[model samples]
Target: MKKLFFILLILNFAGCTSNEEVADRSQVNWQSIEKDLQSALILAEEGDTINIPGGYFKFEKSLLMDDKQNVVIAGAGMDETILSFKNQNEGAEGLKISQCKNITLVDFTVEDAAGDNIKVSDTDGITFRRLRAQWTGEVSETNGAYALYPVLCKNVLIEECIAIGSSDAGIYVGQSDSVIIRNNEAYRNVAGIESENSNFVEVYGNKAINNTGGILIFDLPGLTQYGEHIKVYDNLIQENNHRNFAPAGNIVGVVPPGTGLMILATRNVEVFNNQIIDNRTVGAAIVSYELVAAISEEEAVEADETQAGSAERINSDYELDENYNPHVGNIYFHDNNFQNSKWFATFQHDFGKLFNFKSPFNPPDIVFDGFMEAERSPAEILCIQEKQKLVFINLDAPNDLEDLNENIAPFVCD
Candidate 1:
């Protein structure tokens, strides 16, 4: 039924461009737009420019580019140049660029692709500027997973872009290094901006609102890359209370609605100068991999046999890196204004099992799992100097109330 809705939704856009509009296309004399674009990409030389003239450039198939370098595909401003994939006939993405370098995809709009809107993988020195990627329809599970995705790349910069209505994440940087994503607007997605198994990145000056969660920095098991050294500051993270439409088995499936910001297993992260407000759940949470806490059935049974599932075991089958550092450390939060946030959503994964559900879910602005690497003193492991009137929880023990302390002495740091 959703697929049928997508077809009709795309048809509306396709149907809007009347025959008079089609007859007005005279910038490029091409029999097939997709083929012409493909040939242009292949024939492009080093430091060459492929300028897409101003008009509706629709495609029934994806545009695939691989092994190219020093090329730029520029269009008339994003509002003027429209690329529609309403009836995409082939491929998993609207545009897939791989094994390329110094590529720029800017000044265009890609609308209603069946899969990810733009996927750039195994490429370096990429820039996505002033572009819009969207699925124009009522928000639902049928939306694509990612709007602008860059994976396994280095030296990427994405700025001044707009993305909307992605089922999973609006802008996702995965297994990439040295990235800067700023000045982007994202909403109505499962996660607005997500960094997964990525390293050496900065995400600031972005507005993320009305999504399932905003600004998730996570390192899940079984991925080839490990996440570290990320900085998230000076962004508006608010009102991310959308429904959790993420499919099961994916690590993000555990994220409930109304999450403003969350960091799991990623180390060396700093979040400051961000306006966090009106998220119905906890404002922000930092947890270890053990707290993301994906336990297998066999492990669950063994724990149940011994003292209320309290016995710990070492499971090695699904480790990502050799060190397997599951604890979160070097996370600093300072000088941010947090307001109107509470335990906004219900929990689904191990977090629910470990947290006291009946206890006022969260009037607290910040929550932690009490599992740190102990690399620093109480002043450093997880430092928080941001002052806001809210409750704080330390779920070090599931049943012990003594372990929970309201004193702010343990968290204050410069």
Candidate 2:
């Protein structure tokens, strides 16, 4: 029985490996394929269905489409049809769609673009299904920023897609509305999946693993929209301890390794029923923007012994938008299974160092910065309910870490 079980396991492993391995494209008609594909894209019209057969094709310039509606770009299969941009010279994205409506891109793999692998902008009713966007080498800061990117788009649906090896976020939706990202897998990227300054977003039934941070919901400054009405649930976020490889000055460079889920300066977000497992850092971190902004200033982090008063001084450095809310509130976490195999936190980034400074052993499963609006109470800002014994901490960041405690009474709400 043991021998039979071991044989079955090896067979299953091999099958999985073959499915994920990149296809060999040693000899192919590269130039001819590129010309044909580009011609098809150019001549495509509204309600046209452009079908690409299964093969590996290399292109030097971007395949672009503009001002077309109800177009369907279909391929044989995600693993069978590959478009390589490793030698691309002309454009940033491998596939760029702009000013289109009701467009659908399905069942293809796009790899190694100069910028985002596939970027669709200023479009409505975009759908990405059974697609794979990746970089086929060692993960580095030079890799494209986002694998499957849709920005300033509406009525977006991204399902059953795979994104890998992005320097920034693998599956990124920014400044978009009415988005649904479900049943996808994101791995080996800085952030597996992220929603930035987007509204009415739903992320669930996804697997985010082997990335720096599994999932992130953020509202950064200077964007047309602020992140609100976000829901992330029923996901497998595990072992996301990959070292950060984001380029300098990128906002996500501040994200420490070993983070499972991070909610930063966002409001009206709900996270529930996730299996957050084995991340070396905190399982879930709810933080205000001030603490993140202060990490870069050596003087600010060290000048105050307690590290509580630095945010006051750091606030002077930035001129933020008048409508931008730096405070994180109206957040709820419930019925999450947070587990950690490693007890110590990461020292890769300054934010991780701050966490280690606070808890050198047995990193807290949930950490809140303890920043709140002046008129609101803790119960109104944050709420948490766990099925297991929860390890929680409040950094009391607004008070310069003066009243750091594990007290959960103030946040307990019916």
Candidate 3:
């Protein structure tokens, strides 16, 4: 009986080895396949890999991967594979992946798109790794929309990416779940990362610098209805100073100046452990109406009405909700280091009523005498006449409200 059992185990091991050998032989060498853009698209059948060589591919029209499954489109590196689109067609994205599953785009760069550089819409199991997208033109020239946009997708990951010189947001995601965006850098854009009508998202370990607004979570008009349950932590969000130069297309180019982290009609959002510094304008602006927050008693409201129904409705609802008080809720900012900012560290939900381009807005009442006084342990200093009456708070304090308030009081005045 023991000899028979040994013989059966040997047969099972030999069968497993034979199956592994067959699987290895079945793999495809994508390099030997056609390198033409049209041929690559044709070869992208189920469970196939397309390896793009190191070169530039100028596309007259947009390249699309629509409704495909289990396709891996990879390049040698971000600097090697370049996709350049010079046409300024309306709604033309450089590389669009729509309604697909198990799609992976890795190690490539896209530049000069008329619309979004890379857009993924209504897809699942997508991953964009080591990708770089940029739009370069005069700051006054109106380019397209976001650089990297993923909307209404699930199980998505955007990691080790760089988006620069976008007319709109560098990276924008909307109405998506189970997403992770990390180790990315965004600069010279409208907003760094704008997410609306999304849930279960994590944004961390990113650097957003020198954009109009950095790291925004807005749930305003003309997108999905409402945003909920988002987390943004440990990001270096700073120096978002680029103004809106993109021509008006979507919600981003239309937003007025100096609105950072615009949170409209969003809920259960947590922002913590971020170094928000030198924003020079408003940081974390929230605006919403009672309708947006669903505070008003529900009365036969259509889904279209709840979300801005038409273009006119989008404009009018946004205008009417300018004074809406019920839209802001339970926003928490804790353990953040703010420095040399030109405006308020946190402009509350009602900030729009206070500050506008033509009007003056009063700062919050909390005052810090100076940096020395702001710290928990006041630093010993040589007092001078120039520094007199300039109340200094201690920077060493765990929470230096006094210093922060004193520094911010002058600008908050209406």
Candidate 4:
């Protein structure tokens, strides 16, 4: 019988070349590979598969997988696994998964974690693939605060990830629900993909550059989930203008640094086909957590592009969430492509005054601090359509500059 079909094709090529990976061979024994990886997740079962045998690992604590269901902690990829907590002293995060269901964390890389590097809480069918979180010095306050952090999750799937140096939010999805952040690659950190108090999130083909603010959709003031249907599309968000190194009081440490796609107190957000450029100030900022909690750390470092940060000193005494609905209406900016952006937006502290008007065109690729929800209506449900050189501003509706109105016939709606 053809020698038993060549011995069953050499035992199916030796069982598909036996896979486990572990590169740069030999000489291992870090406390016996951390006591056999904490006894393989304390004796994992439900469809077990905990490979993890790549290289450098230093763990001081945190590496737990609690209440697991269909666990799968794979590695040997993200540049051949590297876990290091830079000498962590106990834990708050760095591979902490709780109440997991169909978990599948793959291709690891964590490095420098004093807190939050891969936190999955209250999970249910989670999947974070091609992971790689970092922070090798520079851009500090002791970088840590989120890098693939999934909170109160459910049906979450973050794909092809690669977040770097986060001092807060390098891909943070808090108080979650059904979310899907795709093709990620956030740089420097401090909000390069954030969706707090989450609900139905759908950030597309992400690539938020530089950092400080390239993709945020918040709804803070005590969570339990109050965020709405968010849908930012095909992103590329540019320049991001780094320099925010969060940590002084959290809430993205006062974001401002050429932002690109920010929407606080979220409510049915639906921005589309983005490309946003330069970003020296705001290429889409739309507030209302009472106008960023009433800005005042001296209005966040002057040069006031409509001052929005600095000094509520985070943890502003808690107390919020009696149903928490600080209003920010329908919001649905369309077909985006704004380039260069005023780059600074004519100072005064930085965001408003619409380039202090005096002609010279080009400003307003969306700002809207004019809070909204007096029932809301800037032409019914604010739906900007068929963009023709982005421009908009409702800083509280003060009109001038020849009453700027690029086709404002009720902002046309569906």
| Top candidate, metric TM-score | 2
Model 1 lowest lDDT segment of ten: 2-11
lDDT of 3 by residue, 1-414 (tens): 111100011100111121001112123221211236545665577877776666555566677778888888787667666566754354478888899998988987787787778889899988989988886455444455678888889888998888877766788887788889998888777778877677788889998887777887766545544567778889987766566664433345434344445555565666667776665445554444332323222321333354321111223345454432234344544455555435442232232223322123322211112222222221121111121122222121223322222233222211
TM-score: the better of candidates 2 and 4: 2
- Runs in model 2 deviating more than 4 A are 1-32, 297-318
Please tell me which model should have the higher lDDT, number 2 or number 3.
2
Per-residue alpha-carbon lDDT of model 1 for 228-323, expressed as tens digits? Answer: 999999999988877777644345555767778999878889999999887766678877777555444354345345421111122334454566
Rank by lDDT, highest first.
2, 1, 4, 3
Residue 150 Cα positional deviation in candidate 4, in Å, after optimal superposition: 0.8
lDDT of 4 by residue, 1-414 (tens): 111101011100111111112133134333214556766877787887778755566788777878878878887677655676667788767678888799898987776777777888898889999888877657786677787888888999998878887887888888889999998888878788988878888999889898878998988766566888989998899988777767555667666776788888678889888898877666887777665555634434332333222212333433455778765668788888878645344343334334445224455566666655656676444677745655665565322223434444566565
Q: Quote the lDDT for 48 in model 4.
A: 76
Most lDDT-accurate candidate:
2
In model 4, the worst 10-residue window by lDDT is: 4-13
List the candidate 4 regions with Cα displacement exceeding 4 Å.
1-33, 40-98, 101-116, 119-134, 137-146, 151-171, 174-187, 190-193, 200-215, 218-240, 243-257, 264-279, 286-365, 368-414
